[model samples]
Target: MTALRKTTTALISDAAPFAIRAERASDVAAREALLDACFGDNRHTRSCQRLRDGRAPAEGLALSAVRQGRVVGTVRLWHVSAGGIPALMLGPLAVEASSRQLGVGAALMDHALAAAKARGHRAVILLGDAPYYARFGFSAAKTGELSLPGAFERDRLLGRELCEGALDGAWGMIAPTGAPLPKTKASRARKALLVPRAA
Candidate 1:
């Protein structure tokens, strides 16, 4: 496997001076704060956020770049059905402005995609600059018929198939497919009581 598709621990030692790793719960605030600094408050109103809303990222796919123990970059992939095909929606990739020149963003992309492939994910789609993501194998050629819930530029809808042909027939709406959170015991009990008892 290529270095970018190897594992989460793989480091971009030459281009990036920081370490890339799986994101932890403790990194949430720092990550969110970093994203805000990079993308600003308007980020939540973007088209990609529709798929990420109220959904958890694919297990083991959220990643962060750290330097001196502080989060400087973040990227996450969410479980979604590209039309009818299983795929992951990559989004909200952001790196601190101060760290941009250090290649933290690219390194985070590599680490996250690698972890996704290792986890057996078949495809990944994103709404981003075609020119930038093209280097990572994303293209809009196959995503013409696919769309997001909110408005987005057509040419910006890009996808990359982890396995050959994974997205060949993928067409339609991109909707969240992440597992729903389990009901709490109290909620289950309440639901059970609400069911009418047979006479």
Candidate 2:
């Protein structure tokens, strides 16, 4: 058996500096900055972001890699519909530039996927480099007929069925299907402030 089991992973090696763990509320700012530095400001305009807008990530699937108490990597999987089939969307996996050499990205992927499967998720879809994701069992073979909300390189769309044949007959558009986030108090106040009072 490997050091990583099913639910979560925290790789500890004498040479490794970071540990993989479930993303915490306090990691938000650092994770966002790491994403921007890795993906640039236009990251939100990407096709996958459409599948995540106004939606919350699947429970217990978001992960972060921290080194010396600093968030050095991040990954999150959101719920989406693969045609009519329920699935999760894995994406925007980013590691701090300098920490990329520490294998943080791959560790984050492994931990997140294991957690998703442990939670009984059937399958996962992602738009990423087929070469890199292939090592994790993601492939374009089952996603050829699926479309994203915006333009994407066809070859980059991929899926991995956690359960045998989970993605069978999966086709058509991949749309956001995650639970909607409730309005936060700050958001409610901002919206109310934008409204003009009735005269």
Candidate 3:
């Protein structure tokens, strides 16, 4: 196994610095700032953010990498369903520009993924560079059935199965969890036509 895979296994087996922990709401500001610095202001406009908006997985799964009391990197997983099958979405992983080579980002991802597996989340989907994420077993082959709203490099949409065959038959347009589609005037008119007059 590669060092990254080995470290990921270790995180799952031992609750050390790489162990997954609950992210406190207090950590949001700092985490967001780190992400902003990494991805810039337009980050929220990305399709991944739409998948995360109201359905970020519990803070406990929002893992971070801290060094000497500073949050050097972070990773967040969001709860989502693919083809009506529940799965997790991994994204916006960011490391401070100055800390790029320190393994903080990898550690956070390893810890969060192990935690997801332990918690029974069977699969994870993410939009990111295939070469980098492939080290963790993420691949475009598994995401063949999934789709996104905005234009994206098809190979960039990737998936990983935490359990054997977890993504089989999983396919869908990733919609916001708990978010209702916008009510259009035409739909409202249809609804009005269906209702009986009030007595």
Candidate 4:
């Protein structure tokens, strides 16, 4: 098992309480920095990134664990089809190293999953330690036949069905299923000025 996998399975017992909320525009830089600190730049090259590339997170599914106004942890669920079954992909759950033993990572996972369920999502998939994610109900039992667009460890692919039997027959390649994120006003304004002129 990898060092990360070991760390994930450590299971901190005293997780300090933190406020969970929807991610905001201003949180982007901090969130990216946090992810880099935890997962490094290599995170973008992972197989799961293929599903998230150019796609906005599932509506209202990106979240942050904040402490005293600082973004201490983060987690997001992206829209994906688990073998044609509409589901969310949870990933890159990270916390400040100093905050690891305090339970921030676990809190973030719980918050993200609950939020996904509240949004009516039926299932969630991820590639991580089976021993760690199993605590939250994710497992390889239902994901044995599912595959990612890029190469990945078959054993690391895990999933959990929020609604019973959501993954009963789910099998095939996982594909992006989300609508493009809405353009911000600033982006729209820039595009409006770049409109082509007719001769």
The candidate maximizing lDDT is 2
Q: Specify the poorest-scoring 10-residue window by lDDT in model 3.
A: 13-22
Better of 2 and 3 by lDDT: 2
Clashing pairs in 3: 22-60
C-alpha TM-scores of all predictions: 0.82, 0.85, 0.76, 0.82
CA lDDT of each prediction against the hidden true structure: 0.83, 0.86, 0.74, 0.84
TM-score of 1: 0.82
| lDDT for each residue of candidate 3 in 1-199, tens digit (9 for 90 to 100) | 5999999977864544433245654666667778767887688788787676534354457776765566777887877777777778888788887777666677878888888888888888899999999999999987888887777778899999998888888787865553343456336534643565444
Candidate ranking (TM-score, best to worst): 2, 4, 1, 3
Off by over 4 Å in 2: 1-15, 185-199
Q: Where is model 4 more than 4 Å wrong at Cα?
A: 1-17, 183-199
* Tens digits of per-residue lDDT for model 2, 22-125: 88868866776787788876887999988887777898988999898999999999999999999999988998888888888889988988999999999999
Q: Candidate 4, residues 1-199: lDDT per residue as tens digits?
A: 6987767645431244567789887787678778777886587788998897667888888889887688988888999999889999998788888777778788788888888888899999999999999999999989999999989999999999999999998899999988765668446533543565344
Best by TM-score: 2
Candidate 1 wrongly placed segments (more than 4 Å): 1-16, 181-199
Clash pairs, candidate 2, are none
In angstroms, give how far residue 94 of model 4 lies from its true place.
0.8
Q: The CA-based lDDT of model 4 is what?
A: 0.84
Query: Per-residue alpha-carbon lDDT of model 1 for 1-199, expressed as tens digits?
Result: 5765655344444445788888886887687677767777687788887787657788888888998688988899999999999999998898888888988888888888888899999999998999999999999978999989989999999999999999997778999999653456335433543565444
